[model samples]
Target: KLVDYWSDPDRMKQSYRNAVNKAKNKVTTHQGSKSFAQGRHEFVEMKAIQDESSAKTIPPMKDRGILDEVLKSINRYCTQEQFEDLKRQHALEIEEKRKAFESQQKVLKKFVNLFNRQQGTPSSQF
Candidate 1:
């Protein structure tokens, strides 16, 4: 039985792919309608978030089951110094992104102020 199951993994995978494709087509076809589009957008956004969470190298430390077990198993393969280096790298990336966003916000604010001042003219027909 185990051998049979292992041999037929491709068929199982194809079936799942077909089902997902059908669902995606349905969503895209219905997206022109306002309510359906909103619902579909929300569903897609949620799926993206789920995919991101699944792809993360670290899971929350509080869980005690399969996810946590898998994380622990992977951790066993890494040294403490290596893990610390990875953490530091991630922190630096986050800080750089934060700084870039703040700079963009400052530029946008200056543009808004300049536009407002340009429009702050007095009427000539007083």
Candidate 2:
């Protein structure tokens, strides 16, 4: 039904005008990221209206800095409770790594000692 409305030339032209006006406002910093995000959500909700293999389909744009941006954003926006939880989890992970390193070192030391004992000194030298 929505597509049928846009299929009309008059409605499509008006919609294009509204979109162009919004684009101009956005370029001039008169618009906010909120509306852009909402539009993205609407597009996704529309199921993109494309074929599985359509070359014309626009694949979702991915940010190369997404992980870094996410980490920064978390630092900026995380609540105290969330921050404490993350801090605790990070400490736990460090402790686990430390324990594993110590265990590996002990095993290596045991192996070296066993090897040296097996290569024992002669009775005359002892």
Predicted model with the maximum TM-score: 2
Indicate the worst ten consecutive residues by lDDT in candidate 2: 62-71
Candidate 1 residues 13-118, lDDT tens each? 9878988877876434444455755666666655555555678844523222333333244534665656798999999999999999999999997777777668
Number of clashing pairs, model 1?
0
Q: Candidate 2, 22: how far from true, in Å? A: 28
- Residue 114, model 1: Cα distance from true site in angstroms: 0.5
- What's each prediction's clash count? 0, 0
Q: Which segments of model 1 are wrong by more than 4 Å?
A: 1-76, 121-126
